[model samples]
Structure formats: structure tokens, C-alpha cells
Target: MSSNKLSAVLEKQIHHLCLKDFPCGYGTWRKTKDSTEGAETEDTDDLLDLLSCRHSPWRHDKSWSPQAPALRRLAVLTPERLHTDFIYNYFTTLRIVDKGVSVIDDGLLRFSKLEELVLSDNKITEIPAENLPSTLKILELRANRLSALNSLTNCLPPRLEYLSLGSNSLGSHDDIFHLTGRHWPQLVCLDLSDCEFKDQRALLSALSTLSCLRTLVLEGNPFTLAPSYPGFTVDSVPQLSCLDTSWISAEERQCFRGLAKNSDLIVDRASATVSVGRARGIPDPLMRVEENAPDFPVVNYGYFITYEFLSHQTVNLNFDRESKSDAANVIEDDADLQSNRNCEKESCKQLMVYTEETCHDVTHVSGHSTSKLTWSECMDFSHTHTYIVGDLGGLKRFFNKGLYLTIEEEKVLSWPAASEDVPLAKPSRPVKEKKSRKGEESPIKSGSTKDKSKDKKKKSVPELFQDAPIRRILGSVHIPLHSLVTGGQKVLVLCNVGALQTESEVEATQTLEKDLGKTIKEDKKKDKESKQGGGSSTKQKNTAASKGKVKGGQECKMDVHTDNSVSVQLEPVTVEFNVELEKWQSASEAHQLLLPQHNSLSKQPVLS
Candidate 1:
């Protein structure tokens, strides 16, 4: 209780308390105690100054609590050493307040329940994979220098759904697939857009196989091209159902429509005629023939007629004559005569004539044997010769009647008679003549010769029908059918008929028929083989049944039903031709005939 004694006790108690309170206090006091000489005074002064400042750090003496409340959130602006005791029980949410500040060794063990981690917009070239907590849900690593996605793979929490790895230097679609495949099963949304998926197949494959994926943003990546079909407007994304492309222009749409319109189906007879003309040597003079002869009838032939029957036919004949002698010398002189004879005897003889004046009553006959008519006179003979032998055959038969049985004309000059030479007479003696009286002496007076011999001769007769050009008339006919059935519907039949020109058209027709026949035969052989195989199978089944083997009733019935259904479905429909190409008609008429029926049928309303 005495002043001196109390002061000593207080000093001792203060020393002990200071030692226990701050460990650094003892070190500072010891350092002051150890100071020697002049340094002792300086150290004591620093100690006093620290004590004074500690007593009143603020203007008002406020008590500093020994225990601080646990920091729920702490933002550090500057790099400073944190005392272990200061942050051990405090901070839960720690955020870096300054960018480019590395908090590398900051003890983070206090914040054990940290949920959201965002280290975005920093100079974080790399983040340690193990630093991330499993409790984290949102990890934003956007706008960083993450050249590779491998860094985040192991650190990514299963519950971490929202990950923004955008604006990083991740290279390709494969990298995207590699990154996502690890976490995509649970990923509901993926943003690989603008990643530049230059390889469409890789992108498409990745997109297709992603099971949990729903929203994929793939705009601004090229691979979109025009649609497969013209006028097709629907946008497609392979298996997925969304596409975003630039709007098509009106001109492009119009072009598509024009293509579709022009592609509509058409059928016509002129097509067939053109085909025929090409096969034949017939120069498609018919192309111009229409313009030249506008009055010609136009006719359309339906599918039923063979193109062969639509051509002209001309007859050719060869005549062989036998002579008793070689007489080669006289052959040149007889060239024109032989030509005339051949014309009269061969082709002209085969002309068909119709005396009844009706097409149905037309008949044929020969010309040379019937009369001595020439080519030109044949036309006049019809007018002059009243019996009216219409053709060469009719004329021959008419003239061959008992009343006018004509024989072959015989040659008037024999070769021997023409060869006989007449000898010149011996020079005759000059005969003397006496003049009469002076007035009547004129006969011999001036330039008259005593002996005068004179001679001269000439003669001719015209022939008939000598100069007419040879004319070969060609004809053809076709029959039309009322109806034909195709695709289980009755349709009209059109066909071409009559004899065709035996030249090229006939050859082409023959070739077509032969090809068709070969095809039919091959088909028939195949059908027969199939039928035989079926019969064998049926017989085997019967034999097996007769042998008393157990069989499932319903299975056999099902097989039978299936076979019947297949047979019905596979049955080939037979097509028939009912219309034929008529005589060469104008293009307009052909068009009219072929298109009307098709147009009318197309216009009819369906019963359904």
C-alpha cells in the first residue's frame, strides 16, 4: 500500500502482462536492453513513441477488441501480409480487389464453404486445377488466355453447369468436342458458336450424338448451301430442326418457280414422227413441208400404233430377158428401148387400180402386155380408152380377153438382112442429047447436063406416153381402238396402221420388234423358272405333310398369307398400245390429237 512498494509491484505486473500479451513485446524490450552506449537512448525513445501511439491510435480512445467477428466477405485491394490469427476464423467470401495482383500464397483454408468462384478479367494465364472447390457451381473463366481446355477438365465440378470459356484461344470443333464430351451428358446448353467449325461433318456428328443437349447455337459458321430441290423452302439442319440463313431474293425464288413450271410433263405425236424421220433417210423436209402445203390434213396417232406403219411403200421389180445370140453390138442401140420396156413391164405393171372409184375397191395390174401405151399416154388412155382399166393389172386382164389377145411385137429387120451390102454400079456411059428448035432448045442450052441422076429420101412417126416421169404411189391405213387399261384405269387407245416405206423405217421397226421379242422371251423364261421353283416347293411341302411331320398351323397360314400379299404387290401391270400413227399429217393436227384426251382426263374431278 505504500507508494514506492505499489509502484514496484505495478511495474512487475505490467512487465509480466506485456510478455504474455504480445510475444513481439519481449523481443523489442530485449533488443532495447541489449543496446549499448548511445544506441540505448535512441531505442528507449522509439519504445516510448510506440507506447504513446498504441495508447491513442485514434483521436478518441476507443477500445480494440482482442477477437474480431468472422469476416463473411473480405475484399483485398493491396497486397499485404495477413496475420494467420486475423483471417483464420473470419473471411468466407474472398475477392481480389485489384487486377494483375497475384494472391498466389494467400492462405485460403478459412473459406471452406465457398460456393461461386470467378477469376475473370485478370492476368491469370493459368489456374491451378486443384484450387477449385467441389462445392462451386458457377466458375467464370471468360476473357482469359486459356489456349487449351485441359486445364479446367479435372477442376470442373459435376454440379458446375454454367461455364463460360468464351473469348479464349480454343482452336477447333474437335477441341470443343473434347471439352464437352467430358461434361456434356449433363450439359443442357452448349455454346460452341463462333468456334469456326470449318469441318461440317465433325460438327454435325458431335451435334447428333450429344444426348442431353437441347440448345445449340451454331450461327456464323459456314456450310449452308442452296436447297436440294427447286422451290423447296424449308430450312434443314441435318437431324436437328433449326436453321438460320440469309433470306432468299425474289429473283432466286422466281428462277426456282420457272424451272419447276418448265419441267411439267408433256406427250405428243410429233415426237414420234421426228424419231421416225431421223431413222429414215427422209430429210425432215416435212419440217418445211407444212409451210409449203398448208392444206395437208393433220392427224395425231396414239400409242397403240407401231411407227413402222406410218410410212410410204413403193414396189421394185427386176426383169430378166434371154436372147438367142450375144448381140453385144446392138445392146447400146437398144438401151433406151430396154429402159422403156422395163418401165412398162416391171414397176408400172404392179400399179394398183380402183375401177369402183372407192378406196375399198382399188385393184392392181400390169401395163406393157395390155396395150402399146407409153408412159405419157397412160393418163390419156384412161380418158380415151373407155373400158376403164384403172391399173396395169386391170388393163392386162382386160386386154387379155378373147376379143383382144395381143402378141408380143416382133422386130421388122433381121440381122442378116441389115448386114447385106448393096454394090455400086459401073460408071454409066455419058448419053448424047440433041436440042430442038432455037426457041425450044432451052433443055440443054445453058448449064444442063446430058445425063442427070438424082436421089433423096426421109420419113418419121410419133410415139405415145414417151416422156412421162415414173410415178410410184404409196398408201397406208390405221385402225383406232376405243379403250385400253393402265394402272387399273380404262384409257383410250390410239395407233398407227398401214404399210410403211420398206426402206429405213421398216428396218428400224424390225429391229425394235426383235429387241422387244428378245426381252419378252427372257422375261417368260424367268417367269417359268420361278413357277417351277414354286411348284417344287409346294410339292416338297406336300410330301413333308404326307410324311406326318408336326407343323405349326398359324405359322404355315401366316407364310401363305405373306406369300399371297407379296405376289399381289409384285404383279406387273401390262401396257397395251391402241392408237397408231396415221398418214403423215401436219404438226398442228398431231398436237391436237395427242393432247386433247390427256388434258380432258386431267381436268375430270376425282370421285374421292
Candidate 2:
């Protein structure tokens, strides 16, 4: 509508826009004024106008072709003039996100060859299908005002492979009906996360029609809170390789198979088994010899486990008492872990620790001298804890507060030898009689400094192994609860907890360093230009700046050194565990009598 003139905001953002690749062409062409843009797009065979060179308009019929005369002076115009301009037809990809676009106007239809379009984070309420390019293969409209697909689904490109409609208000059952194979037959990956879609049955029934859908994300939907959710979703769409963010495992697929058809078999309080398996590539901390050791050294190292889980507490009331005479004596328990307390403050964030006393010792190949541990034996630590979840909402909360597991390398210096002849002086009097006499004779002197010193020594003497061995925190691994919640069965879940590292984190630090380096250079340039009045002050400032830089570099080096020496150097150890939810019958005898239906569920097909 503005002809060839673009708005001020569009002009500023125009340089960031990119041109799509030609069919069977070399590569994509970027429209940047920088020299690198030409180098980057030089391999392409098609001619591109990076300077927005205007050309005469060509006819849309048989006169326009790839080898048209007007193509020699191709006009790289703004996206708003896409309808009037003929040169933009060469582009196959268009991205106009966060542009405050409220409507899908006729401007986009001009790019007849556009294969991909990203219009996310806009105020688009409805998409007129006629305005879309038929060649579009991927369209991302996430975080938009789209409420329904009735208008858009009618003329959607047949070859559309990927569609992302997340963070929208498409909640109705009719909206789901439009998302079928009949509309987008070739649709492979569909993202419908963070929507208002309710009714698990209706959603699954509608999505089941998309036979080609390989990856489907239905996270943050209202139906996701149902106990039979992911189980039902998985069974409904068996063709999916991924759901939410997790990939479907063979065992998980088998567990939740045929669950959609059987709705009554959904679990309330599910059971799980957690097992800590053997670790590989664990370094022997005692390999480096220390001073003043016994002839034979005793090395002690083991695995420690810690995790946060949800546990339900119930209260019972007495009806015979005068205060509660009106209340009923009989009480019933529900599988749903419903609580009237505030979820923000009381969401069960309890930490459980399996200490050294409970852990089994790791076998050394050649005792303390061994550099590596044997792989055949189990390091020995496993636990099974049951969660009392009423619905998928509780499970979701548990997932948000992920399972925090830390793998610590505990080491002991030495164990005292039995042959060591440590002499102990015999007491002059009976210990109990002496204590009774002292208490009687020195009642007034009980608060004396001498008695206090003696008491302090006595207290400190019993604290064994205080300085014996050093405990180093190797690293921690966060285990996601998605598998636990979505597994949908009371089975032994084996989880491999790998040793954590910092290599993946270096990229962030590197980018930060680059940004800081640019700012430092600019600051130095400004300082040089401003300090023309004095030599002493400038010299002092230079010295101070140099010292600061040196100090910062040293600090950075120390941090990197510590990280490399501790977490990065340690090889990844495989810690396996199984977590199973306990049965409600085992929890209480009264619950067993009340949950008679649970016994019959095993005979039938269970979903959750």
C-alpha cells in the first residue's frame, strides 16, 4: 500500500532480511551491505540484487520466466511491495517475525516460490489461506492471536511438512478437527504446545487422523493434566517418534501400547523402582600416594544418592470426642494427591540423602594402587520410592521441580590397623564412681574454666574421621521426570546418570568474552581521546587499567583451571537406577480394602 516506500522500522530491519535459495541452486543469498555477504553468497548460480536495483515491471503471464529480460536488473524491494514487485519471486524463504503484523495481507502471495515463512510473535488473528504461497513447506506462527484454523486450513499448501501453532488460543473441539491429514497430508512435525486445548479424548481422536505426523508436541495443554494423558496420546499416535521433548523408547512404547482404547485402566497412585547401576571410568583418588601412611593402606570410596519426590500425608479425626462428635467416623482415601495448602510454598521440595553408611564399597582392581576401578561389580546403591500423584497436574509439578542427583567422589585416607599397639593408661578409680564423686564434690566448680576445657576436649575426642579423608564434589546430573511421569506403568525404570562436565558451558563464556573485549576496546579508545590534559594522571590510569586487566585474566584462568581440574577432567561415570511407585494397598490396610478396583485393573489394559 505504501508503493516502493518502506516504513522507518522496516528500513532498519530490512538489512537483516535474507533471500531464499533458488530451486536446485547452490545456497541462500543474504541481502547485507557488508563485504562478507557477497563472499557468502558468491557460490550461488542465480543473480541477486543486494543494492535494491530497480527494474522495469514484467508481465505475470508467459512473458515472465527465470530467464526474463527484466531479471537482469532484479529489484530487491521491501517485503511490503512483494505484490507489486516481480523480482521477489526468486526468493523461497521469508521471515517477518515480531513486526507488529496484525493481518495476513496480499503482500506475501507475491513470493510464489517462497517455501518457508516465519511469522511468530505477532498479533495475527486470522490467516487468509488465499494469501499464502502454495509452495510453503514450513510455516511457524507461534505466539500469535490465532484462535481457529477454519480460515487457514482450507487453502493450506499440500506439501506443507512442518507447522508450529504453539502459544495460541485454539481451544475448541472444532479447531482440532481442522488439524487432520485431510488439510495438511504431508505434515510431519506439528507443535501445539502451550495452547488451551482440553478434552484428552477429542484431541487424541483428532490428531490420530494425521498418519504422517512423526513428531507431535502437546505440552502445556489442559488435557495434559489427565492421568491417561501421554499414555493415551502415545497410544493414539503410535507413529510419533517424539512427544513433547522426549523420544519414544521401545520399552516405553510397549508399556503404553493399546492404552487409548482402555480408559478405565488409568492409574491413580503409580509405583516405580529406582536402581543405581555400576559406574565406568571412575578414577581412583588414592592413586597419588600421601605422606605418613600405614604399610597397608585402606581406600574407601562410594556413591551417594539424593533426590526430591512428592509424598502425600493424610490426617485422621476422632468422631467420639465432644469437639468432633458431629463429624463422621468413616473416612475415604483418594488416589489423587489433592491438598488445600499453597502450592508455591508447600510443593514437597524435600531432599533425601543415602549416606556412606548405606552405600556399598567400590571394588578396586589392585586395591589403593589401582588407577581405575573394575567394571564387573556394582558400586552398590539403589532405592525405590513411590509418589502419590492424583493427576497429571501433580506429575507436571514434579517434573518442573526436576530430580536433582549429585555424584560425589568420597575418599578415605586410611583405616587404623589392628596390629597397631596403642597403649591406654588405666583409670585410677572406677569410672562411674569417679564421675559420681566429682559431680558431688565439685558442684560449685562445674562452671570452672578447667572443667570447661576438659569437657571441650572430651567432646572433640569422639569426633572421628574429621580430617581423615577429603570429599570432593565431582559434578551433578539433573534427571528429568518426563520419563517417570509419561512411562505410564508400575515398572522398574532404569536411569543412567552420567558424570557432569563444563565443556558445553564454554561457548557462553566465550561469547561473553567477545562482547566484553569489544566494550573494553571502546573504553580504552575513549580514555585515550579524553586524557589530553595530563601525563601523570594518564600514566597512573594506564597502570591501574593494566593491573585490572591482569587481575581479571588471572581470575579467569584460575576459574578455568579449577573447572578443568575438577569437573572436566573427571570421566563420565555411568550410574544406573530404577524408581518405582509403591502400591496404595501396601501403604495402608484400609486402603487395600477400599481399592478393590485396583486389583482388577491389572487383569485389564492399564493406561497410566
Top candidate on lDDT is 2
Q: Pick the candidate with the highest TM-score.
A: 2
lDDT of 1 by residue, 246-295 (tens): 34454544443322222122211111011111011111111222223321
Model 2: how far residue 366 lies from native, Å: 45
User: Residue-wise lDDT of candidate 2 within 252-350, one digit each (tens)?
Assistant: 776666566554444333223334445554444433333444433344454454444544322123223574424312111212223322231122111
lDDT of 1 at 209: 55
Where in model 1 is the C-alpha error above 4 Å?
A: 1-98, 101-110, 189-197, 207-608
TM-score of 2: 0.39
Per-model TM-score versus the true fold: 0.23, 0.39
